[model samples]
Target: MAEVFIGSEEVAAGRVTRHELRRWYAPVYRGVYARKDIELSLRDRAIAAWLASGRKGVVAGVAASGLHGAPWVDPDVPIELVGVRIRPQHGLVPRADRIASDEITRVGGLPVTSRVRTAFDMGRHLERTDALVRLDALMWNQKFNRADVRALGDRYPRAAGLRRLLELLPLVDGGADSPRESRIRLWLLDAGLPQPETQIPVLATSTRPVAWLDMGWRDYKVAVEYDGDHHRKDRKQYVKDIARLRMLEALGWIVIRVIAEDKPSDVIARVEEALIRRGCSVEVDDLHRFARTFAA
Candidate 1:
């Protein structure tokens, strides 16, 4: 990808006039510009924000998470920067807070929060569901160790969101593959179900593993999977998913599948039914609490 150059650089090169810059380039930042045809991706926006900071800021929050290889962040999510000392723009959030040098790193020549710092920052600053989704994506994509985040938390003893970060630290599971998967796991736990293991390998008689369940109870041979739209839209993925579910069913495993429209209550009911069919005793009162929790 061609780098989005600053307007000053183009002016210095004498390749463009003020009118040309105004007409041909789209202003991504106050003074930074990109080719009008270029799609403003997450990376592009981050670069624009860095340029707007005079190249002296560290990307943080969801923007930094995307730079660290997390896949769930939206491309248009505000470009957040720390140590920038700049006024916030329409799509830029500049924080004038102190960020230790150890918490910053470089990715694709742009300054960003270190992987652990990004995870910790998101966990502390975002709402519970959003924070878990970002943290889960970071862990899944980068294989980041949870211990690093815990240790980093010690450095920011009085951070604004420290309490929430500490609360989510124990719940961060690297095994989840997507944001929805993480949300489903949280819902299950809040519903008082036994914590299901994620990305578990389903092995047949042969040494090789046949498939992996999104989340499951090994003891009861029950599995739960959240199927997003892509699983149905992508022809090959849809076929493979069908074959995989059939194999698991043939192997005596009960699979509970969730989709975008599935309500939390419906999901809990389906999983509870599966658990009962597997000969597990599920408490009716606990199930009622699950419904209440969802209602809340």
Candidate 2:
């Protein structure tokens, strides 16, 4: 919609008074105002805040995550700004950390942290599973990979969370389609299961593609699929899922379905059993490596 501006700008335009500023423009920040009719998106809010900061704010944290095209971040999450020393205020997370010029970029003319830096910061600030979720989405959306993260870490050797980034780097995979998919993949990895290839193609007798497994071990013809809410709520999607699973089973594949309600340990159990049934071995100790993550 319309570009939001500071009260001084509207006053300079000579089209509005304080009464109009109060009535027609909604306060996004103390002095920044957006037209009342316009719905503010995260970007709009970020821009409003930057304007409120006298155009000196550089977006960071989860706010920057959204700017980089990663989804599932809370919309109500505070807009984070970093430029100079500042204190947190309503609807804003401010920091005075050193940010290189190259670390800044723009989306729709609003300043934001670069994708690699955004992800690197997220890895430090967010929980491990949450960070992986954002990282997976970032990779899928931006075509970025682990190398970028490594390079950023190298550039900022003394930066916080380098160890966390290194720990998460091995877990990051672009093939995950949703946060749940990313979590499932990580759970399996933490349990010491064989790394499953994502979005694996199931070939027909003619060697043509029939379906793609969400995650699979080709040797065992086992697939793990995470069904989101849409799968159950949409009738057409339900029917297609039935047909697809039947086709997969007909091809001598074992399909394991995981849902949001499934407990992490139970999920590991089911998949572990399936792998064993297919004549594959699993390390017993590996199952407990990630046990502490679920203790809470």
| TM-scores for all predictions | 0.89, 0.91
RMSD values, in order shown: 2.8, 2.3
Per-residue lDDT of candidate 1, residues 213-268 (tens digit) = 89989999999998999999999999999998899999989999899788887888
For model 2, residues 38-112, the per-residue Cα lDDT tens digits are: 787888888877877778889988888887877776766788887755556799877666788898998878889
Q: Enumerate residue pairs that collide in model 2.
A: none
Alpha-carbon lDDT of model 1: 0.85
Determine which window of 10 residues in candidate 1 has minimal summed lDDT: 287-296
